[model samples]
Target: MRALIIDDSRAIRMILGKTLRGIGFEVFEAGNGCEALERLQEIGRADLALVDWNMPEMNGYDFVCSVRSKAEHADMRVMMVTTEAEITQMIKALEAGANEYIIKPFSKEAVVEKIQILGLIP
Candidate 1:
């Protein structure tokens, strides 16, 4: 499987890369929503994306909205992997078409669990 990891932190991206690869996923990364969009445009779609909530230039919610607006990208799995755990924020993410939400500071095991729950892994 393939995944696109979007976050402002290169360290987070590296961590996700290591974890995802261990789970048998080939991972790509973008530092923010704008970069994610560019990656999507240049190299085709990924099976899933782990998007960060707070980012410079276009944030996660807007990114999800953009993805949903494109019929071709309608089925891409989008998970909000963020620090914001507020119920209202969760609702907004879902409303914007996120397939799942994962709070930050979670373990690698937790990340894997959520990915499995989203059917990104077996």
Candidate 2:
């Protein structure tokens, strides 16, 4: 499977990338939502995208909306991996088209479990 990790922090991207790679996913990364969109354009599409909420140019919520708006990327799964832990924030992300949500400082097991629950992996 192919996965994209979008976060402003390079460390977070690296950590997520490592976890996804360990789980047999080919991972790509972007520093923010705008960069993620550009990367998606270049790569065509990814099976999954793990997005961060607060970003420089564009946020994760807007990114999910943008991806959902496009027919070409309709099958792609978006998971918000963010620091925002409020119920309202989670609802907003889900309503915006996110398939899953993960709060920051997460365990690697949690990430894998979420992906498994999404049926992206066994």
Instruction: Name the candidate that leads on TM-score.
Output: 2
| TM-score of every candidate relative to the true structure | 0.96, 0.98
Q: In candidate 2, what are the lDDT values of residues 38-112, reduced to their tens digit?
A: 999999989999999999999999999999999999999899999999999999899989999999889999999
* lDDT score at residue 94, model 2, on the 0-100 scale: 97
lDDT of all the models against the reference? 0.91, 0.94
- Give the residue spans of candidate 1 off by over 4 A: none
After TM-score superposition, the amount by which residue 50's alpha carbon in candidate 2 deviates from its true location, in angstroms, is: 0.2
Clashing pairs in 1: none
RMSD of each: 0.8, 0.6
Number of backbone collisions per candidate: 0, 0
lDDT of 1 by residue, 63-120 (tens): 9999999998877899999999999999999988999999988789988888889886
